[model samples]
Target chain A: MALIKDQQLSCSHAATPEMRFTDWVSGGSDAGDAVLANGADDLPSLLAQAGKLSMIAIEFDTFADGRGFSMARMLRRQGYAGEIRAVGDVAMDRIDFMQRVGFNAFELRDDQDALQALQKIGEVSVHFQPSADGKGPAYMV
Target chain B: MYAYNEFDQTLIDQRVEQYRDQTRRYLAGEIPEEEFRVLRLMNGLYIQRLAPMLRVAIPYGLMKSDQLRMLAQISRTYDKGYGHFTTRQNMQFNWPTLESVPDILADLAKVQMHAIQTSGACIRNTTTDPFAGVSADEIEDTRPWCELIRQWSTLHPEFAYLPRKFKIAVSGSSSDRAASQVHDIGLHLYRNEVGDMGFEVLVGGGLGRTPVIGKTLRKFLEPQELLTYLDAVLRVYNLNGRRDNKYKARIKILVNALGVDAFGAMVEAEWQLIKGQELRLPEAEIERVKGFFKAPDYLSAMHASRDLNDTFAEHPQFAAWYKQNTRDHKQAGYRIIIVALKNQLQAPGDVNHQQMDGIAALADEFSFSELRSTHDQNLVLADVAQRDLFALWLKLQDLGLARANVGTLTDMINCPGLDFCSLANAETLILSRQVNETFDDMDYLYDLGEIQLKISGCINACGHHHVGHIGILGVEKGGKQVYQFTLGGSASNDASLGKTLGRSIEQDQVVVVIGQILDVYVEQRQTDETFLQVIRRVGFAPFKERVYGTHQRSAA
Candidate 1:
């Protein structure tokens, strides 16, 4: 239930409250509900609604399931600059990589310590490749 | 060897700490075992049947003397004083404790090595020809590109969690020693008509339950476009590859389903968007990485000596070892010696700490303080002067490494099957020993010429049995070990999967079956024709008839 933004504890602010991925995709009556996308949701259709959404949260069904990372990256590449939050099975070890792939806000699993996870976000000082962070690859740097 | 810069070192150190935290959390019951499994596997720790197995990555099979010594030290300190070399050009320590794996990775980090992506459903250690730079047949040195890909794939954020484990191999030689055809992404470096270096990008080739040869996605990808193209290929696989069924998750299955042309088009569409992005390899970075793999300063006057020939003349055993175990190097008077780890007495690719230390010393004295691990589960001293061949052979002989069967049938690539691996359905080491004993004569093996005999305890094909000239797969039926044999497969320039000869046979009959097959080859062979060439010429019918006899074929 904790939200972390830019490696610090943050409060959730959104135009539309949490909506299930299925309800968001079913063309529901609620037009302004900030949607939650499943890891397996179709990206192009999701991106089509990017302009209307205030925020979009992606669910990692399992921590080992990495389809969400690619989904987040695809969302970012498609020019969705809204708050992209990651929820479910989120742990401290995966924060740095998740951040690199464009997950700005993390709704970690209930067990993870929000403060401890913050320290882990910047623990890895260098990354070998360029990512959503827009920092050049370490080699170019 | 490619020396790690400060950035590379920092990343590894951070990774070690991260894994340490994960371990502590998992041990503290904060992280569940199922979630922690992938985390540990990404760091190259696998909980095995007997103990925790740690796979240490050796990028492109290159290692320095100090690094090899560090591995020996780790084996002595952490495991049972030995390590196993794998067909993917990595090392495995089979006796590590689950609690101590993070500490082992820290130790590896001190020597600029890490097990990053050595296993798991991620891009693995990028392997290349062991004789990469020193091979006379090489069009270009491939280690630099392997290093680039290694860095690109290391902790890659988006592609980390794929449907299945992915493997990539590179080769710059006309001869396909790296087995490029059987990898998820195979990069074959070559010069175009105008002398521009590029790669023929092969996609979706792999060995497993559904083995398929990689198809060429791009006929030639420019050198600068390698990473971007690779990124596109991986992205396509990650998003579109099947995740519903674990068995059908590998890119090979997707490539077959989508068809190579459609897959290539998808990758092309993706690449067209990211082609000139930051992932492009800058000229300076390419040159900087290439600098690490430059040729060593070989003595100008080094040449084959008359005294060495005289010594060889006196010692017939040394002569046999030199002729069979050594390969011609590009540099004059230099030879690449394959330190055979497949001696009949020792387990395939298992080297004791003592042997490791001795090999390190040998590398320092004879091979410019550098060594390589071949995909054949053997080590190589790639820059030995021809005049030092006698001395090197004698030293290797002292260590029981001079098997003189480098390319022979006895030098088989085998997996640590049911003996160590939890996934293996049957035993591999026993069958390996039986086959070794049945074909122990070096003279006969030499006459038989080059043959690749590979065995796997399961269909996962870690031993690459699918691509072996004589492939043997172990299966458990009715609580008994049964083996299936195939013939005519290869991992060379003309890579092909072997066809099954017939029905599975009992374990006790494996040796006799192989013997019968070789007998057929010997009976029908022309002069200088190898076992593979003979099989290709006569087809599998002749060998199958002899091995199974006429009655067994109709036994429905």
Candidate 2:
């Protein structure tokens, strides 16, 4: 398994138990607790708790299931300042795009390579379109 | 064609290596079959019945002569010595090995081409009117906008895996040759009263088991807001489009279920947040993209050629070919020549290596060194001089490409079918040949003017059968191939889906039934009325009764 943060290899954070959005909301857990949301989670409800959560790790059931990217963009737009990580199915080739859509951390599948994923981010220096990263397109740059 | 700068080149090159590594892992069994299938499909590689098929994108169907030659060379060296042009304005090689696909992509990258996003559940190649820049009816050249969308959608992270395959088309001409109404998102470029170009956006149109014409989402959108609005629409679809059932997963179903008004509201709301963000295209970049599509040079003094008309007067064969296979160009001295690939016995779009080479040479000599692949499985020399039409026709005849079947009954839009496609339910090549032979006479075909006969092996509608004037869908019934007929469909400005006839018939009866239907049209038509107009005027009752009524039933 590989962990990449801010386009580089990073040390793992201290372990925190992941709780569902329903459990975190109904159970009256601490506001700053870590929470996990799948692609199917309600985005408005998640955004309601974005400021309180320390980290929101959106899980991808399958790599091809791209609803998570939308969810991540919504969270970022809704003022989620804490770490927003992508969990599961994080292949190396998908890392750059994941980063573009406001994924600060990626927890790749067990078989993926971290160094390769880190290097992949630098392969393309400029992209034609802008994303949640707020970096303008290459032409504007 | 847009030249690839270093950024574009590097990204494509990186994608080649990335796919290469993925192919290596998949072949090594490190990646499972199910997992690698999506990856390969995103790169336009499909596992077909006979061998692996690779669909290379010809962006908006524009290609230089060298690029055409490169495609012919690839077909010669990698697979069989032929490539099939597709109804989506792309090319497919049906006999390549899975192991060699990356090497093929590497070669394509050398020529600024790749197969990325040609297939799979993603935004596909953005097609446009083949006569984008050269048509007399054009309001704005749509190819530059298509190229913009192409760059934005290629390898887009948020849309790589949508509910199902997505198609976008742009039509700049009033004629609607790109079939924009039958795409996932259709953009019609036009000038408002003030003469500033904008787009009429349509969403949720598609052809499949459930064929539908797209609905207008926005009456008019400014040119600079294309990508932002598209992003908003895609974001809405990504989050809400059905993923449980692949059959009902296209954006059309979602749009239908939600209602167009509600869908438009959602996209409008989403657009409010990202409207003026970084995705808004700058004026400079728009001009930069537009600069790539500047008009080619033409001779100033060569208006309507008297010599050409004289030659046409002397030779009726040349006159017939000219009338059927040529279109009016925007430029005074230029003409767009349709190079028909549907020769008598050949597959609809199958071009052998020699034909490809011949096409390249002809393009270099007469058509500004550029050629276009049309949505109807034909090639276009978009910038031919009117005076050179005779020479061009002669050269095309030598290559066996002067079939004079553009928009005729024999110029059918057909899929590769079960002969090559693993997804097909029945074979279609023999049926194509049978139908062509039955309607072979040029005089007879010209009399039956402007018939769009499309055939698909299944309901996937890769052949676009649903929009064909006489649509034929081949299905497997009780382990036997059956062909069903449909009527009154058209993919033009008046876009409508074909309604199914009574029932399917055996494969052998397909040609006979078509003949009977044509017989009815011949017997009960006003002078110079098209088959579609006659059907619209009289309805399908007369034709259906003739086919399914007592007289034809007894023969069956």
Candidate 3:
């Protein structure tokens, strides 16, 4: 139940490698540190620092914003094995899609029911394409 | 026809259970009325002004004999023993109770069919040329591609809540019987310069208050990139399509807002990011879907025998039917036969349980056990041998399925209108009956030749009046039904929206107006010129002056 402000993660607040797991990762932690960003361009650097990352969150400004899904998929493809959580305007309908694209955790508002959100993940019985879960064949499979 | 695989079957089964739960919740007051309304519409159940109507998708309008029989059985048990074939190649049952819809869906699921996305804002039942596999002029059969789109678009999570409904049509034949240009997305299959089969994609074409022909967005989209390109298009529309005003909310408005070049550029930009990605259809997958649509083992029969020609010459009814209802099949000695649903007394597109069973049986016996529903609301037996047509005709006559009015005036495309549709502003079935009664001569109709009479109950154009040769639109004036006429529309290769002829007339004057137009055509037409040709040649002036001259004088 973590809250993510819209523009907290910036180049100025970059997290350093020395930062420990318990430290706050948002703006107030420190400035001029190597903080994590969630855009497609940030995937390579984030994968390079995968072990020290306590948490990685991607922003979905709208419910139907799917670029974040691809960014998460790229993270998984580049072997960033960390807690990738989706933040911002995510709803019950988008949980399964986020999961399919390799978001291990989600941060929703406290009023939202987590159980119903979890049920949405179980809606699709099969996936036509392979993704971060390392399941399903490539196109041929 | 593409038979459903296990995955398809399971998904529909799950959908039925899901809808059943939703229905139970709605009836039990667990969900509020407004919330339940969206839920029911998503499941293709509409609580109309009268009773509940359920539209079942007939995927590209192709059906196995067993599926048709199941529909007939459902009609007898759950409905009023009849179903209406819709303009989008689906069937609507007008009398199913809300409580019984889940059972009806369950029955549909059992036959590898469901009512999913048929009436929703999401991608609806994908329609293609009714004669896809059998048409002689086809570059490639478009059924597999339609089936692929059907799978990809069913209950697609992101596109489920669009501003308005979306329709996609594909045409493989040169004649464009699917009316591709008038759809939200119209795909015309053609061969590129290097002999590669692909689609010329058109977007933003629709018929309603504003009817615009879809402009070509892609010159050639290869077979595999079809879905990914469509994904790009739908995603663009979902994200940016107008949502504020229902009138300007269709994807057409968005396409018109952004000129075709800018819209195509946006779609191309989106597609460029995902073109060769997972959504790109793999070669194996294309073959996997295409394998299901391989042509039936047609009997290697050659010429129509002297006996068939002799029979035609002997019987004028048979001759007229042969000229009209029958079409050339790809294989030699085979004929594609249309079982016209346009009987004189019955409403257009109405096929009862008995007729459905008869068609199913006939399809099983003569048509490779398959049937097709045309965009024109006629049933086709796609692979009947020419020698067997006489035998098929006798069996069809016994079942009353052999009306032999495929392209005649009686073969009108009339909407349910005020009769069953809640959206209808005026009564179309009454007007249709008047037209049918007035033009009862088969010989005269055969001479008139290939006239399309499309009637819409309202401006919604559900009956496809915009593309009809003689479009009749029913409007309401002073709380009574009035009919307006449009001339020179055609849905074929030379597709054009109809031009409105003068004033709206009372319901009783519909037949007289139609008669006067036909009289004008007879007087002005060159030899063998059809109604549409005559109207196009004369530009509706003579007919307009003849029908409305006195009215103009009175008004003056």
Candidate 4:
């Protein structure tokens, strides 16, 4: 499956092994390489493993529910430098906003063209807000 | 009044094109309806009951005359020759087709307007007092701060897809004309004892099935920390607000769930990390924006005030209109004329294309080529000279815009209910007409002074009925529309939610009940007591007794 990383469409890149947040935090489960968390998951539990985890995949179950964007932003602010991958219903319209709020890697849906979705990240270059992308807002600039 | 710079212009221009593409994709079957609904909503296009309603933002309710002309032109070209001004101080074309919305937006872009964030689940238009800069008893001018918020929240990446819609309002006046208390974030701009400007921020207030008055989140916030603090609050809401139920998903529910103190603490912690850093508004930028809102130059002609008084004696209708529709401006020679959209006209807030063009022309000639739309669904021609008021009133009378009912009983805030909106349970425009017809006597209306009657077709409270002194909410029961009345609410500085009266009146009995309620107020009131003061003085008992205390009362 294709994954968009650093604004480039990597056609043959395979996803890292990951586990659900419940499985990772469950009493007797293996230390998965990556943890899959939804918007409702508490960050304190995930921040403890922020150092050891190779990646944390935040499920974008619905674009309308914006908890994923907040989780991604909070993940960056809490010093999680690992790959933050977006999965589930990741459409082109939300891709640019996802990147601005700190989604670096995306697992594009099968029907979406990886290249076209990659081009969506910079659709509107002018920025009004300084978000998790580390770019300054134009007004402040 | 802040003119769009290159960045602002470029962003809006690109946004128009982007919306055009989205429309193209949606119409061409490249995007599904489920996905297109969200996109169209974010662009302020609602696939409503009758047709697509296009709500265009007035950017804190301030519009240039040319922009009003553009709206008139669009109404004539695309809509059904009229537009409805909403309580958010925005205008909505009720009959635009889905395909024509992009072209309408393109037309709006030529005049520095867009519908972005007007109806989305994101931050809607930041509204302030309609008499913002020109009012007599205002704190500081709130337009500059509103412009700052307007720009900062435009396409804000983090806030674009909130759990539900977020509304922010600011009031810098002693009287809260903006209805700041019922907003998600109500910024009460104030000056401290040390003479520095700060904000008293209120959070979590909203009106729907569940109504709440916002609680104070921060007692004092610095000017520079405005955007940052707002960011912290939004981030907190976006992260922790409920997603399980649609009805319980507003930020108000989250604030009440986790107490206001807890919400404030979390916001403080998040705000401390980014408060003075990223979104800190620069002093130069604030000053630059403030420069745009400087009061217009007053004409230096020193005409004797006695001449206008003599002219008023000659025309009693003009005198009544001058007294009712005009307000004292901060400038000595200037006055603020409220063009009432609540005549026995078509509907409460609907202005025809010809009236829109006429008002635009009047604004260009009398006022300073500027107009302000009030949240109560009226337009303001703010900078008219006091001497020109009689002439202006005559012209307004010709256009049927001078209803001479500024704050009287007929000046009601009514929602376009079941006829247009699928969310409504009953019709409101016709009810509004009935009320106007029942209270047609101007002298009697003048006697019943300053009554805020707000009505909504459903519990969504689009008409802001919760805060009205006399609020009416419609509901469907036994397949019939019945409207319940709430009493003693105020959306002013002293904000309070009204208490619901005893029983729901049938559709035809609303006007009669209103008449009986006003009669009770008149009977019990002191010499100078208004309807609300009488309600507060005697409590809701009298109004209840007048309506549902006994069947011996008037029958519906």
Identify the leading candidate in terms of DockQ. Answer: 4
Clashing pairs in 4: none
TM-score of chain B of each: 0.98, 0.98, 0.98, 0.98
- Of models 1 and 4, which has the larger DockQ? 4
Q: Candidate 2: lDDT of B359?
A: 99
Candidate 3, residues B171-286: lDDT per residue as tens digits? 98778989999889999989989999999999999998888888999999987899889988986776567766778878899999999899998888778877887778888988
Model-by-model DockQ, in order: 0.69, 0.63, 0.12, 0.71
Label model 3 with its docking quality class: incorrect
DockQ for candidate 3: 0.12
Runs in model 3 lying further than 4 Å from the true structure:
A1-117, A127-141, B303-306
* Candidate with the larger lDDT of 2 and 4: 2
| Residue B409 in model 2: lDDT | 91
Candidates sorted by TM-score, best first:
2, 1, 4, 3
Model 2: residue B213 alpha-carbon error in angstroms: 0.8
Between prediction 1 and prediction 2, the one with superior DockQ is 1
Candidate 1, pairs of clashing residues: none
**Candidate 1 lDDT over residue span B1-556, tens digit each:** 7898788888899989988988998999978888789888988999999898999999989999998999999999999999999999999999999899888999999999999998888999999999999988989999999999998999898888898899999999999999999999899999999888999999888888988888999998999989999989999999888888999999999999999999988999889989988788889999998898888888764454325677777998888888888887888778889999998887899999889999999999999999999999999999998778888888888888988888889889999999999999989999889988888887888888888999999999988888999999999999998999989889898999999999998999999988888899999999888889999999988887888776575775
- TM-score per candidate: 0.97, 0.97, 0.87, 0.96
Q: Give candidate 1 misplaced runs (Cα > 4 Å).
A: A15-33, B301-307, B550-556
